[model samples]
Target: MADLKVGSGEDIIITSGLGSCVGVTLYNKSTKIGGMAHVMLPEFPANREQGNPAKYADTALDMLLDKLRKKRVNLNRLEAKMAGGAQMFNFSSSNDKMRIGARNIEAVERILQEKGIPILGAEVGENYGRTMELHNATGKVLIKTVKHDDIVL
Candidate 1:
């Protein structure tokens, strides 16, 4: 398992094999600071909520926005980009109700919209998995789908 790394305006953060999940990257151009969160579920676990808040879609977006704000980054200037959210499991399975990936994508979009952030780019929803890379300085997102080529969004 490769580690997801973040950088301040000069480096790129990357994650791979996002199946039935969502990957969110928030970047501050001025400070070149950014972070990426690979969210597996739409909401926080009901039984456990004391650990890292960034592990969840809603809380992670809030936390990322707050960090950028603290660094003097303009909220209106902040742009959002995302990738993943595939239907990885068999629909015939008993766990069909667990559409966590799609739920995660929806949650992320809603959060960004509510915060008034513009979605500059996205590559989400399909049967295939994806590998994503986020560049902090330029807010550029790159996505590589399974058995497919890489794309820069």
Candidate 2:
């Protein structure tokens, strides 16, 4: 796991091996300011509390938004792009309790929608893992899957 940090207008953020995890990249086209959060869970953790709030999906969205706002990047002018939600493991049980990837993807979409951010593109929900890069300067997202190599969006 790379050091997850919020980036400014001229920075680039990247993450790798997004299996059953969601990577959300929020960027402002006008200012080229952005942040990328790799959230493992959809919501806040029950077992632990009161640490780095930016490590969770729900709180990370708010934290990143606040940082961008301070930089004069309006939420309304921002665009979101997501990647990585893979059903990487196969379970023997017939129970429908192991849909972590789908759940994470749903949670990310819902949070972005609630925050009034537009989704420019997304590549999610497959059996393969992905490595993603968010270019802050252009709001251009590049995704590379295990089999497909590199794809630019």
Candidate 3:
């Protein structure tokens, strides 16, 4: 659901209920600072100017990076880990608009690439919901799902 957070040191940022939504973490291991975003859509709506930026993958990472920049986290030292983007609903037609999870994943990856942030690991695209946590102190991302063993990325 449209939420984002930034933390430092031993803080752990967590997000749950990630069905068809993406959870992304940007971490600077040297500084022990990181940010997490629960992105609900692929891109921000072009017609709207007054919406939560955290709701869209295209805008969420920028917001997160700005916050991290304010905290003096070096962009050059940052790495990424991501989880979620589950296809919770089944669509009979092969319409792209129905593939929200896939679109979110693509948007996030593209944005990160444009920013020159390398993704260290990811757990994405399945039929189940997920929860993700970013451990700021360790730059470790933990992905939790109901049907599978907990994953560390």
Most TM-score-accurate candidate:
3
Given candidate 3, what's the lDDT at residue 153? 98
lDDT against the true structure, per candidate, is 0.75, 0.81, 0.92
lDDT of 2 by residue, 1-153 (tens): 322456766678899989888888888777778888887767777888566665567877777778777778777888889898888988887565488788888888998888788888999998999988998877788999868878777
> How are the candidates ranked when ordered by TM-score, highest leading?
3, 2, 1
Q: Candidate 3, which segments miss by more than 4 Å at Cα?
A: none
TM per model? Answer: 0.83, 0.88, 0.98
lDDT score of model 3?
Answer: 0.92
Q: What is the overall TM-score of model 2 with all chains considered together?
A: 0.88
- Which 10-residue window of candidate 3 scores lowest in summed lDDT? 82-91
Return the lDDT, model 1, position 139.
72
Ranking by lDDT: 3, 2, 1
- Could you give candidate 3's per-residue lDDT for residues 1-153 as a string of tens digits? 798999998899999999889999999988899999999999999999798988999889989999999999999889998888889988899999999999999999999999999999999998999999998888889999898999999
Candidate 1 wrong stretches, greater than 4 Å: 1-6, 46-49, 93-96
Error of 1 at 29 (Å): 3.9
State which candidate, 2 or 3, has the greater lDDT.
3
Models, CA RMSD each:
2.7, 2.0, 0.7
